[model samples]
Target chain A: MSDEKRYLKLHLIVLALVVIAELIGTKSYKLGPGTIVLLPMLYALLLGLLTGPKFLKIIDKEDMNAAEGLITVSVMLLMAKYGTNIGPTLPLIIKSGPALILQEFGNLGTVLLGMPFALLLGLRREAIGATFSIAREPNLAIISDMYGLDSPEGRGVMGVYVAGTVFGSIFFGLFAGFAATALPLHPYALAMASGVGSASMMSAAVGALVEIFPNMAEEITALGAASNLATGADGVYMSIFMALPMCEWLYRKLIRDRAEEVIKG
Target chain B: MKLSLKDPVVITVIVAILTLVGNFVGYKIDPITAFPGMLILFLIVIVGMWITKIMPGNLPAVVYVSLLGIILTMPWFPLGEKVAELTSQVNFLALTTPILGYAGISLGKDLDSFKKNGLRIVVVAIFVFVGTYLGSAVIAHTVLKLTGQI
Candidate 1:
């Protein structure tokens, strides 16, 4: 009947189709592929397309909230199962963690890179505000509400976080690669090498290594297999654990109430 | 609709059962394959939201889809042989959120604006980066050194 209603129906139809596909695929072929398409990257693109530049503006008008129960529960479940692996995974985590943390700092570096430019652009308020504000990540939409990135200053802080996350990956990945070569360690270096490359990059590296050293391919794959799985899950965990919460806490203290007032006025 | 954890839990249980059966009935079909298959199923469920237009855009669709996707795919329950298989396969690198987060953040449309404010953002990100890294490093090297782990 109404335009909005019609659009809603279309979205519903697409959802139904996806469900049906999953059911049939599982029952019949027992396989699932290309599911990576559902990553937050896709969502960010979608939000950008639908909401445009004002997207952050709209998100800012909302109250800071997060799925406190769900996130905490999910992470708890994950920790319970994966926590023990701490012994085996710890060394790797530490080696990678430093790089990861550096990447986070490197991200902050990117934010600073933008700071003076913001002032120069005469969008100082937005610049200053954006600097500390946690910019929205489309995937973060799920838990972002719980954290206070919804506030102006929060958004400003988020802007920094968002920037950091982006550069952090490349820096970390690159760092990992370099360290792997420079260091004498095996697993740690290999993992770092793998880290610098995205999934695809790792895949290529593995393929090339296997090709060049055919005898060692299986060994390399065996060593890498576990990390591959962890790579898939860890990113999600850190986002939920470290990134989103940090954004929320900062926003709540500095900008939450003020944002609501601004919105009301 | 009111949110409840019941559905996810139930789904997880059902998957556990299926994994067991599959391991028993079809010896060739490993949990790993089935794991991805489960992710595919989860993704499909979200497609319904998209079809109905209730799904706002790609991002929401992706988030809901992946959350459910990983749940379905991750081998929480293991059949006899697959039990050890899943355990050995689990590692830190398998946790894929950071790279995915990076990809998402890098897609920000406000890069130009962000670039303009470059100094502040970079400084903060660096400070945070150093803080987190150094803190963790100290804990690992100093705290865990005696354990011979780090």
Candidate 2:
């Protein structure tokens, strides 16, 4: 098929999905103190997955590749949309206190809980990649560059990167929604944490929050955008100097013979 | 394969138009009403990507797009309020629908790689996402309470 014909087909599929998802509209279920809000975005994502090659195979390789290329471009527009939200609320976000900057340190939670658990799960140096950071594109780039994606670290990062790509946003969406209702945390705080240094993940989490706290939609969107910006802008440096090194130290402390294991296995 | 600037720029325009349909259906905003704001945003997306293309280094286009967005919409910018007003009519949720729809369609090829990652990777992947999100939320909650922002 001609490239134009292929693209037209790909886009038409997406258009139909978008319309159907929007038509279904937003649905909210009350679970505990919080709400489990299912937005059209999630439905659109799931519907796309159902039609994709892994399941229905509605789209061919060329279509997927073409679609993949569009992601970066499409997301930039989304960022632009969200970025406008930041300007008017700049004062509020900054005034929200040191939490704006301090919350970034929370990224370390990955290694804190993930390291020992991944070790318990029987993963090796790969734990470093899996636990060091969220394994988004930037984190993945760091690992791939340092270890060349063929190393244990590379495999570890790639595994999570792909996994995150497929399911990470959905996880964030559900978890964020569930936590908002199940826990006693304030919506603003939860909003800030939704950033997690990745766009889709932040969007999913923020989307759920907006559904639950419609009153705070403006604040939720603003703080989430600001926090995500901070995380993304500063994350690469932090991962290289702080997070990666910390993960290495923890790995060495937990496993006595890093060299021996690699040699033996 | 290297990604040239052309494809994404074209796709951005396509998505801008696509988003209009979604905005109309979901948000009840007429396409004509959302057109101006969408045009402004579309221009920003293009200019931001263009800046990244010409600029040195490998920074993602998003960083530039985001920074430019903040700058152009800030109070000092002459058209900031107008821009904000027009764009506000275009719902944020509307923008996300097509983006994820595209993402969903693209997910099939990655499934094999994800499956090969095994159960352990999936478990660990969940841990990583949970840690980042929950950890940050907890910290934010604490700081807000301590500082009385919440």
Candidate 3:
């Protein structure tokens, strides 16, 4: 197919998916301790996946290729929209600047929590790539550039990047909403937390928050957008300077400790 | 992505048109009315992308784009306030459906590789995401409360 025809086909599918998804609209379910909020974004995502070459095979691989570059573009536009949300709330962001800076240190929790579990699960060197950071596109780039993609580190990073793209946003969406309902924290706090830098994940997370707290949509979105931009800005350097090394040190320690225990035995 | 200068503009126009349909269907706004707001966002993003392309450092284009958007719409900017009012017609969430729809469509290329990576990595990855999210939330909550922002 011609370039025009191919893009046209892919877009038509999206247009249809958007229409159907919006029609179904946002739905919330009460299940035990939390609310599971379903969003049009979810439907659009899953249906778009199903229509891909792997499943129903409705579109071409080239069409999928077209979709790839556009992810960054769409996210740019969305973040630009987020930028608008931030201006009016600039004072609040400045006041909460300390919280924003401190919360990013919370990112270290990935290595802290993930590395030990990965050791227990027998992940080895791959754990360094997998657990060091959130392992989104930029993090994946860092891993590949540092340790060539053929390395174990490469496989570890790729594994998570692939898996993350598939399920990250959907998980964020559901989990954020559930946390908002289940926890005692303000929706604004949860909103600030929702910005993980990765566009789909942050937006879906914010979407869920807005769904549950309709009246606070502006504040929730503004906070989420600011937090997300901060995460993205800090994420690249922090992962390189901090996360990767921490993962490496922890991995070596845990492995050596295990070897020591074996020697004692 | 290989691009001539016009790519952002072309893509923006296309996405804006698509967003118009979704905005009308989902939000009950007329497509005619929403198009102008969508165009405003498209202009900001295009300018942002241009800034990123020429800027010396490696900051993600999103930040620059966002900064520009923020500047152009700030209340004190006078003209920015009008930009904000026009753009507000297109809900920010309206932008997600198209991008995510694109994300989903592109995912097929990676699905098999994901499967090959085995279930172990997927499980650990889930932990990676969960840990970052939960930890960040707890800290943000504590700090917000301490700071009395909430």
| Candidate number of the best DockQ | 2
What's the distance in Å from true for residue A240, model 2?
Answer: 9.8
- Which 10-residue window in model 3 chain B sums to the lowest lDDT? B2-11
Place model 1 in a CAPRI quality band: incorrect
Compare the candidates by TM-score and give the number of the best one: 2
Query: Which runs of model 3 end up more than 4 angstroms from their true locations?
Result: A97-101, A115-265, B1-6, B116-122, B133-150
Please give, for residues A177-240, the per-residue lDDT of candidate 3 as tens digits.
8888898878877887888877668888898889899999998998888888777656766887
Per-residue alpha-carbon lDDT of model 2 for A1-265, expressed as tens digits? Answer: 7777777787888899899999999876544333345678778878987887667878888887777666655666777776776666555555545887899999989998888888888888888988899887556546644554445786677677657866677788888999899999899999999999777778889989998999999999988988987786567667877898999999988787656777899
lDDT of 3 by residue, B1-150 (tens): 665422757766767777777788888888778777777788887887788789896656655776787788766787877788878888765777786687678767766654555688888887888788787888988998898887
**Candidate 1 deviant stretches above 4 angstroms:** A1-141, A144-169, A177-228, A231-265, B1-144
Cα-based lDDT at residue B33, candidate 1: 50
Report the Cα lDDT for residue B13, model 3.
Answer: 73
Give lDDT tens digits, candidate 2, residues B27-55: 89999999999988898888987898899
lDDT per residue (tens digit) for residues A1-265 in model 1: 4433432332232233222222322211111211111332333223432322344432211110211112211222122223223224334444543433333322232233444444444433344344322232322333332333333333354555555444543433343344334544343224323422134334433444444446656755643333443443354444445544544454443455556877999
Question: How many angstroms is residue A155 displaced in model 1 relative to the true structure, after the best TM-score fit?
Answer: 5.2
